[model samples]
Target: MDLNLRKAILSNIESNDQKQLEATIVEAIQNGEEKMLPGLGVLFELIWKQSDEQDKQEMINALEQGVKQETTG
Candidate 1:
């Protein structure tokens, strides 16, 4: 699970030696795995930590609108 990966990532970052993480990410992307989607999902889930309320609301509204439009149209 991500518990190990999160720990490793934290260790790598704290150690300032993220080459393994970078290489692993690049290799996964090159292999055409579904890693990109989950990466984005993790990013999206954590976005509120760095986003303002208004920006967060707008992003959620836009995503909901897009989903609704996709489903209806």
Candidate 2:
């Protein structure tokens, strides 16, 4: 990750009051959000780190094949 982005995240975390974070967490949990506010950023980071162009292409190809097979069947 870029140093600036890391710093910005740290800064945002540091800047937010704890009560607000707790409220946000409560809302996310209560609403059954697939992605909690806190985890969304980390989830994005993980996906970005793990997927390359080639991996994306392979995934698209697999999906295309599955669709074709379904249609033919």
Please provide, for model 1 over 22-41, each residue's C-alpha lDDT reduced to its tens digit, 9 standing for 90 to 100. 66556656887774655534
Worst 10 residues of 1 by lDDT: 8-17
Please report how far candidate 1 places residue 26 from its true position, in Å.
15
For candidate 2, write residues 1-73 as lDDT tens digits.
4467555555655556779766655676698776465454653464567999998788679879999998999
Per-prediction RMSD in angstroms?
A: 5.9, 10.5
Worst 10 residues of 2 by lDDT: 38-47
Full-model lDDT for every candidate: 0.64, 0.66
Query: What is the Cα-based TM-score of model 2?
Result: 0.33
TM-score each candidate: 0.50, 0.33
- How far residue 68's Cα lies from its native spot in candidate 2, in Å, is 0.2
